[model samples]
Each structure stands twice: as C-alpha cells, then as structure tokens.
Target: MTIVAEPQFHVLAVDDSIIDRKLIERLLKTSSFQVTTVDSGSKALEFLGLVEQEEEEQQQQQTSSTSGLSSYHQEIEVNLVITDYCMPGMTGYDLLKKIKESSSLKNIPVIIMSSENAPSRISRCLEEGADEFLLKPVKLSDMKKLRPHILKGKCKDQQKQHQKITCSIDITAAPSPTLVAGSASKRKSMEDDTLAPQRTRARFSSETLTVII
Candidate 1:
C-alpha cells in the first residue's frame, strides 16, 4: 500500500521589500509551510479575502455535486500569517488590526517580523495581539521556537471542540425511565463540577509542595 502525506500548512507573507519577502518565502517553503508571498499589505489583504471567497464557492460546488454533504478536502489551509511591520500604504500594524477585527480572519495566528527593534514598537505589536514577533534578519533557529507555540494553540482549540462534543453526548445519552427525571439535575451538577477547579493550593503552591514532598 502506498501512503500519501497530508497537504502542508499555508502561510501568507506580506512585506514591502522584494528581497525580504522572497527570503521569508524561501525559508517557509523549506520548513514545510506552503507560502504565498505578496509585495504590499494591501495586496496581502486582497489575496486573503479572495482566497476565502474562492474556498467558500468551492465548498458550495462540492456540496451541490454530491448529496449536499460538505467535503472534507481543503483546497488551502492558511494557518499562520507573517508580515513585516514597515510597509508603505498599510503598515503591518494596520493589517494586523484589520485581521483581528474580522470575524472570519481573527483566529488566524499572525507574526510580526520587523527590523524596528525599538521597545515601544515591539510593545505595541504585543499589545495589539501579535502572536509572535521576530527581529529583522530572522534566523531559522528563531523561527523554530514559534512552531511549538503555534502547534500548542491549535491543540488547545481542538481540545475545546472535543469537550463541547463530549458534553453534548453526555446530555443526550441520559439513561432514565422518566423523560425528564434526572436530566436537568444531572446537567446542573455536571455544569458545577465542570466549572470547579481541579486543584487548590496556596500562593506558593509549587514551592511548598516541593519542600513538603
């Protein structure tokens, strides 16, 4: 039997410098990410929106072709976004803010790569919710550090979705003679138990536990 590897994750890279954009694109391609490079922030935004629309249309076509069942195949998966902070018309900050505000695009992780190493600039990017920041002349080793965090975030999101499905199953799988007999009470108790913290410890919990143990 022949096994095929899954499609690589996509990353949209935006930068004004031709050399910088090409460098980032090459780096991402070698690292297993399918990179799409755009010269300016405005072009990046246009490409993003266009790609989303095309995906939706493709999904609709696929559904109609079958018995209205949604297809599992993904044409493109844009899981991460990397952009330079200094662009002409729309700066990286502006693009980041736009992405954060859009409901459809807000969940995509964004990394700000820039040469501006000033404290204020870096602080502002963090404050505006950039997931990762890299100084200009990015190193391959530095890019590797961000992979774990990005993967962790993806795992957490999957876990949350699984939890929701499990809760729904539990609620619907009530085994009782009476239709309404233990359902509501069981749900309430479950809700409370779910909300309760798993552990309780003092302020210096780790240190105290280490010393006592």
Candidate 2:
C-alpha cells in the first residue's frame, strides 16, 4: 500500500511596512493560503531564487523519499506573490516585470497592493502585467472578493486569451436611470475628502471574483 501526500500551495507577500506586512500575513493566515512575507523586493527576489533551487533539489529527492530513503520532503513550494507597489530600491512594478520575464518564476501570480489611488498608476501596473490589485486599508470583504480569483491561478496571459468577447449592452435596461444617477452622484461625493464620514461601507455578495483593482 502507498500513500500520496497533497502538495501545499505557498504564497509570498512583499511589503516595506511592518504593519502592512503583518496585516496581510494575518489576513492570508485567516484564509486557506500559506503565506511567507518579506520586507523588501530585493529580498523577495532572493527568496524566489532560493525556492527554485530548493524545488530542483526536491525533484531530485522525490524518488528517494518515496522509497523510504530520506525524511526531507516537507518543503513548501510558492505558487503566488503579493507585493506592495511602492518600495525603496526595486519598485513592485519592477519586481513584477522581473518575475514575469523569468522562465522559472513567470508562472507565479503577482498581486499588487498600494495606497495610491491614481488611475494612471493602477493602469500602468496592470499594463506591466500585474495579476491583481488591491487598495490600501484592505478590508476582510475585499480580501474575500479577491481570494477566489487568486486561487484560480489565472494569469495575465490567460486573461488576454479570454478578451475576445466584445458584446455591449445598455445598462439602463438592467437598472433604473434614477438609481444609476444616484449611485454615480454618491461615488463622486465619496471622492471628496470632505465627505469622508459619508463613505459607503464595503459590500460583499456571493459572486464570481473577477475584479481588476
């Protein structure tokens, strides 16, 4: 009789702020992900290299372990990367680019989280190949909304492959014009810092997670 072990899914979170790192770690811990965090992009890159080396060694030792030759098959393999956009030396964008360009690490999904809400900044990050984006002050609801998609292992290449559907429909038919206008007005009001107290609470419903930032 033989017993087969399930492979563990590993996640790497990179952030410069200790508090933010801790928060993300806690959030991921609450979820099903096994997360490892680093304080710098450079360190994250080094850690990625180490993971690859360890994976190579593991592949060589897999047969040995199955034959009861050694007890060294407990290493975890990283499958995802979460990073902050703003960092000291190598920015998250730069790090993402490096990872996407590398053959060994290109398959890993990279999620970018940042406080900057500039549309241009978010657009640039997405254009540069970020898997997903999360705003700062992350809430539990937002994390839940992102988890399913992240866990699905969908990368930029996969998204591009699915972008051919070009059907447009009038949204007015689905919702009342008054309601739409009111929602738009409320969103505009929330953009003003003076209406900080009137900010709408984050809402979560059972829906497919496919949000881009």
Candidate 3:
C-alpha cells in the first residue's frame, strides 16, 4: 500500500520592519508552516512568481486578456498571504486588492496585520476581502485562527470523498433480488385478491316457486 503524504501549507509574510519580519518568520516556522518573508509588497508579489506591474498593465491595455504573465509562485503553492497593513511603497491593502483582482491568484487567503487598532481601518480591510485582521505583533494564538481557513480546503475535499462513499454504500445496501421479487409477488397477490370476481350466494324462492305452491 502506498502511503499518502500530507501537504505542508506555505505562507507568505510581508512587512517593512526587519524585526517584525524576523519575529513573524520564527513564529510561523515554529508553528510548522513553510514561511517566506519579504520586505515589501513588491517582493511578496515577486515571491509569488508574479510579473511586476505587467499583470496590471496588461489588464489595463486589454480588458479581457486572461493569461500573459508567468507565475514563479506556482512551483510552491502558497495557501495564505499575511502582510503588514502599512508599508512604504505599496500597502497591504494594495497588495490584497491586487491579489483579489487577479483571476489566477484571488483564491489565496489574505490576512492583514497592523499596529493601528482603528475600527474603521479594520472594517475597510474586511470590506476589501481580507480574511483576517491581526493586531501588530501577532501571537501564537492568532496563528491558530489561520489554520482553520487553510484546513477549510482540506475539509471540502474530505466532504466530497465522504459523499462519494455514502452514495456507493447506498447503492450496495439496496434490497437483494430475492427480497425485491418477494415484495413484488406479495403486491401482485394483494392486487389479485382485491380485483378478483366475488361469488354470490344463490337465494332459494320460498313460497313463490310453482312446484312448492
């Protein structure tokens, strides 16, 4: 029997702060996720194997052009993208919007981390399709919330397998030929009893018969 290997989830971490990048890297590695840390959104997109500015440029030139840029990121599939909300050149929100707009990359989950606890900012991130918003200096506990979203994909795959198995069992669990035939025979017998001609009792003429009179 071949042993199936479990997939290791890879995460992309983006931050302009060097210290925070190191911290996030260590925490993610400790949690057993394959981690890649980048200094900016441009590098993060580069790590994802996306062509810089070209994808956006192409989209602007041709509204419906689907495929032109090559993704180096496809080699190691990234299950999640976690980025700092505030960066110098391109902000996390900008990156999130780019990822979401990309037809090829939009499915990846994006989590935003910010030092600011502004409710309006958080609401904006959520509205922009950020999966989770984490307060800056993320903790191990916050990492726990990250797993469920990645595992959701696995759960859906398992559910599909379960449905297939259930359908097979239902098909196999059907009544046997003998049992089916017996039921059919019983039904026919009942139908014959209900529809068969009934015999009536013959009535004798008491005093009205000529011979008797």
Candidate 4:
C-alpha cells in the first residue's frame, strides 16, 4: 500500500511587530503548520482574498497598466488566522469581524493574541467569533488550542460539502412536476443518482472515513 501524506494546514499570522511575527511564525512552524505571516490585518485580508473594492480596483488598474503583471489573491486554503489584537490601522477584533462578515471566509477559524489580559477584551474577541484568545509571548503550550479550531473548521466544511452532495442527489432523483424535460434530462438525472454514491464512496474510503469520524 502506498502511504499518502497528510496535507499541512495553512495558517495566516497577522502582527504589526516584526519580532512577534517571527516568533509566532516559528511557533506555528514548530507545530507543523504551514505559516504565512502578514504585517497588518489589512494585508491579512488581502492574502485571504478579502480585499476592499477600492484596493481591488487599484490593483486591477495597476495590472492593466503594467505588462505581464498579475494580481492573485489567496491561492491556498487558510485553515486558521492568528492575529495580534493591537495592530495599527486594523486591529485583530476588526479582522475577526471582517472574517465573520464574509460568507466565503467566515468558516475559517480565527485566534486573537494580546499582551494585555483585559477581561473585556477577551470577552469581546470571543463574542465577535474569535476561536481563541492567547496572551502575548505565546508559548508552545498555547499552540495546542490551534489544532482543535482548525479541525473544527474542517469538520464544518466537510459537513457542508456532504450536505451539498446529498442535495444534488435528492434533486436529481426526485421528479419535478413543473419542469418539462425530455428523456436526455431523465437519463442524466438517473446517471447522477446512480453515480453520486459511488463518487462519494471513492472520495472517502474506509480509512478516510475512519479518520474523519
């Protein structure tokens, strides 16, 4: 049997301090996560493909003016976002709100870190949908909280995908009264109904299912 290597989870770490950014990057790498560090929450948003319309328009203009220039955003999946709570311009709480507000990116987990142990700040971050709040000078022990949030996000994504698959199967199998379709539609629907389960089974083998469960 050929052993398949597990894909590494990607993390986006946002911090204004260069020292803190390096430290967090090192800690995340040591924990076996693929890390991408950004200096500000705005930069983090850009990395995650959540750029504002004005900036997007500017990038488009720049790309048009420059030959062979391409502006690509977020080519990889970011499993988690760990940001410093006190960044200039866009704070971590602001970043969390932006993530939570977005339909496509809201499901990704976010963690907030700060040097101050203010109760109100912690509560506010958690209330605003931050998965965890870590104190500054984050330790390896604090890294343990990261995995659970990533796994939770993964599970949620899988559940949504499964639901979509099930819905597709149901729609193809069920007969619609209002629709006036020919044999070709019926045949395709039958094919979909027949093949959906097999495709799902192939995608999630016994071992994969076991691991997920």
Highest TM-score model number: 4
Mind giving the per-residue lDDT tens digits that candidate 3 earns over 1-213?
Answer: 111123457889999999999999987765557888899998887776555565666543443212222333445667789999999999999999988777656667899999999999999989988989999879865876676666554344346446442222122233421111111332343334323444111111111111110
TM-score against truth, every candidate: 0.60, 0.57, 0.63, 0.67
Q: What RMSD, rounded to one decimal, does every model reach?
A: 15.9, 12.6, 26.3, 14.4
RMSD of 2: 12.6
Residue 190: error of model 2 in Å? 28
The number of the candidate with the highest lDDT is: 4
Candidate 2 lDDT, 1-213, residue by residue in tens: 211122334678999999999998877654435779999988887676523434555544442321111134334456678899999998999889888766545667788889988899888888877878889977544554443444344334345457542211212122322111112333242224223443222211111121212
lDDT of 4 by residue, 1-213 (tens): 122224567889999999999999988766557899999989898787767755654654544211112246645778899999997899999999998987667888999999999999999999999999999889975876776677667667667666442322222234432121122332343335324543221111111211111
Q: Global lDDT for candidate 4?
A: 0.69
Q: Answer with 1 or 4, whichever has the higher lDDT.
A: 4
Which parts of model 3 are misplaced by more than 4 Å? 1-4, 52-73, 153-213
Model-by-model lDDT, in order?
0.60, 0.59, 0.65, 0.69
Candidate 1 residue pairs in backbone clash: none
- Runs in model 2 deviating more than 4 A are 1-8, 50-75, 154-213
Model 3 residue 62 lDDT?
41
Worst 10 residues of 4 by lDDT: 201-210
